[model samples]
Target: MHHTASSHSGPDHGTPRTVAAHRQAFHDLLAAFARPENTEQLPLLAALGRGLAMDILAPLDLPPFANSQMDGYAVRSADIPDAGAELRITDPIPAGAAPAALETGLAAPIMTGAMIPPGADAVVPIELAEPDVFPVPGKAATVRLPPVLAGTFVRDAGSDVRAGELALAAGTCLGPGQLGLLAALGITVVTVYRKARVLLVTTGDEVVEPGSPLAAGKIYDANGTLLEAAMRQAGLDVLRTGISTDSPDELLLLLRRHSPAVDLIVTTGGVSKGAYEVVRQATAAQEVEFLHVAMQPGGPQGLGRFDGTPFIGFPGNPVSCLISFEMFLRPVLGTLLGSPAPRPAVKARLASPLTSPEGKHQVRRGTLLPDGTVRLEGGAGSHLIHALANSNALVHVPVGTSALVAGEEVEVWTL
Candidate 1:
C-alpha cells in the first residue's frame, strides 16, 4: 500500500488511514505503553468482569464428599440385583447429614445432596422406588426398590472439580458462569488484573454541564458523560474531571495533576483540525499526533503518550466519541487486558439502501429486527447522538463499496 502521510518514526503518525489500519495503530500505541502490570484481590461479585491474574486452584474437592444425586433410597448396589428386592428401611439421611455404613439388605432414605453412607454406591429416585412416597424412617417394615447398577445417580467426590486442579486459568474473564464456578469452589476472594485507570477530559468553550442555564453559545457537556458511561460499561475504571476546559494551558495543567494517578488519559473534542483546538494545540510539542483517518463520524483522531502515560484524543462530537471508543479503544482493551469481552461481528440483511463516501469506511447506526434485518436509524451525521442512543447495532460500509441496496447482506456489530 502507498504511504499516505509524510515519513514518521513509527507505523502511525499524522497520516490518513482506513478504519482497520487506524485501529491497529492505536492498539500498537497502547501495547507499547510502559504501564506496569498490576493485580488486585476482590470479592467474587466485584470481580465479575475483571481478568484473572492467577490460575485459581480448587481449594478442595467440589462436593467435598460423595453425595446422593437423587432423593431416594441409598443402598449397596450388590445387595439389590432384582427389581422386586425388598430391604429394611433404616434412619433417613437428609442433606448435609452424615450417616453410618449401610447394613446388608437395608436401604436408607437419602435426600438429594445428602452425603452417601459408607458402602452405599447408588441412589434410586424416590418416584421410581416402590411406594413412591418415602415412608417414615424405621417406621415402615420394608421398602421395595428396583435394581440399580453401581454408581447410578451417585455424585462421586470431586466429581465437579478435584482438589489442586485449575478452576480458572490466568487471563480468564470472570463472567457469571465463571464466577458461579468459583462460588461453587468456595472461593470468596480472587486475584484479578487491575483495570486501567483512565483520566477522562472533555474540551471546548461552548460545552457546559447539564442543569446550567444555557447561554447563547453553550451546549450541555455530553462528551464527558457519553465516554465515561461507555468506558465504565466496558469494565474500565474511569476517573473523570468535573470541569470542561477550552484553554490549552488549563488542559495541560489538568493532565499534569491527574497523569500520575492514572494509567491512561483520554480527551474528547479539540483534536480535529481547527484554529482553536484545545487538545491539539496543548500537546503540539508533546508525543501525541493528530490524524484524519479514513473513517466517517470519527475521521479525526489522536494517539500518543503524555509524560509517559498513554494518551488518546477523540473527535469532540458525542457520536464520534462513542463510536471511536467502540471501534478502536474498546477492542484494544479486550485484546490487551482480556476484560470487556469483544463484540461479535455477524452478517445481517439491510432493510434499506444506503450510500457511503468513496474512500472512507462508514459506520451507520441501526436497530436489528427480530427477522434479522437491520433498519438504519439516522443519516450519517457525526453529531447525531440521539440516533446513536436508539441504535442497537452498527452497520459497516467498508472503503471499496459505496452503495448497498436493500436486502443485501452486510457485516454488523451488535451493541
Candidate 2:
C-alpha cells in the first residue's frame, strides 16, 4: 500500500508489520550498501572509545615475581612452627627491592610490592604482627612492626598475569580500563580498526539553524544536530552535514558531490511520498528502495546506493529520526565499524497495558522499574521527545502482540 508523507504523530500512523521483518530489512540494506573504509593512528591516551584491530598480549607476567602483598614479615612455612614462633628479622625489604634467598631460621621484613624472598609461603600484614622495632642490617637503622603475625608476605610470580597471554581480544573497544591495562604493560602503540565516515544531511524549509530568528511554525534544525551528536557518541566519524532545501536537484547534487568521500550518506526528512519530498524523487533514480518498514515512528525508510555509496533517509520528525538511528543504523554499523554492540535490553515487567498494531515493532519510551519493570513514560508517540528524553530504555514490544496487560514481561534496550 502506498501512503503519502504526513505530519509525524503518535506511534499509530503507519501500516503495521513485524519486528523481525523490519530488522531483516535493515540487515539486508546494510549488506547491500554499507562499506566503511577509513583508518588512522591515535595515541594510547586518545585511544579510548576507539576499536582495537589486533589482540593485546602480555609480554611479562603481572607482578613478575612473588612479592609481598602487605607490609610485614616473610618467613618459611617450615621454620615457623604453629603459633608463637619468633625468628629474628634478618633483613628489611622495602617495595620494589629484588628478592633475596631465605636462609633457614631467618625472617625478612617486606613492604608492599616487594618480592618475597625464596622459601617464603604467605603474607601477613604489619597490623597482624607483634608490635616492636627491628634492628637494621649492616647499618644503625630500625623499623617497627607488629609482632606475632603469621604467614609469609609474598606474592607468587605470574599471580596476576602470565607472560605471553592474550590480555585483550581483537575487536575490543579500548575503554579506560583496557587502556590502563595496556599502559601498565608498558605498551606505547596499538593497532586499532578504522572508524566509519558518515555524510549527514538535514532537509526541510521549515528548519532553521540555531541562533536564527524563527518565523512562526519554523523550528531549529534539531534532526541534523541530534543525528550528528548521536552518531559521534556511537563512535562514528561524520564526514559532512549539509542542509538541503525541499528541492530534488539540490539534494541530489549534494549527495552525489559528497558520496565519494564518505562511507555512508544519511539524510533526515523528505523520504516520504510527499509533494515536497525531494530526497525520495531524487534518490529513486539512484537505485534506492523505499520501504514502509514494519515499525512504528520510523516506518518510512529509504535505503539505496548513490553511484556506489550507501545512503539512508530517515523521517523528518526529531524523535523519529533519532529512533531510526538507534533501531537501525547504530546497531549494524556500530559492529561493522568495530564499536561495541548496543546493550541488550534489560528485562522489565510491563507497568501498564500497552496496545500495538497487529504487525509492527513498537519501540516505546518508558521508565525502568526498580524491580525490572517498564512503565510507559507517555503515549507511544514519536513526537513525544520529552518522554523519550526521560527514558533510559526502549521497550521492544514485538509485532502481532496486539496488547500487553500490565505486569507482563518484556525485553528492553537501554538507550
* Span of ten consecutive residues with least summed lDDT in model 1: 1-10
lDDT of candidate 2 over 297-396, digit per residue (tens): 7888776667767668899888888888888787776555457546676788998898997677788888886888887887778788778778888888
Q: Which tens-of-lDDT digit does each residue in 1-415 have in candidate 1? A: 1122232223334346778887887777777421335778899999989878777889999879999988999999898877458888889999988799999999899999999999899998889878888886557668888889999999999998999998888767789999999988888998887888999999888998899899997899888889999999888789999765788999888999999999889999988667798997777667776777888889888887788787899999998898899899998887766677888788999999999997888999999999999999999999888899899998999987889999999999999
Each prediction's TM-score versus the true structure: 0.87, 0.85
Q: How close is candidate 2 to the true structure, as a TM-score?
A: 0.85
TM-score of 1: 0.87
Model 2 is weakest, by summed lDDT over 10 consecutive residues, at: 1-10
Which regions in candidate 2 have their CA more than 4 angstroms from the true location?
A: 1-38, 132-154, 240-242, 369-371
Best candidate according to TM-score: 1
What shift in Å separates residue 298 of candidate 1 from its native position after superposition? 1.3
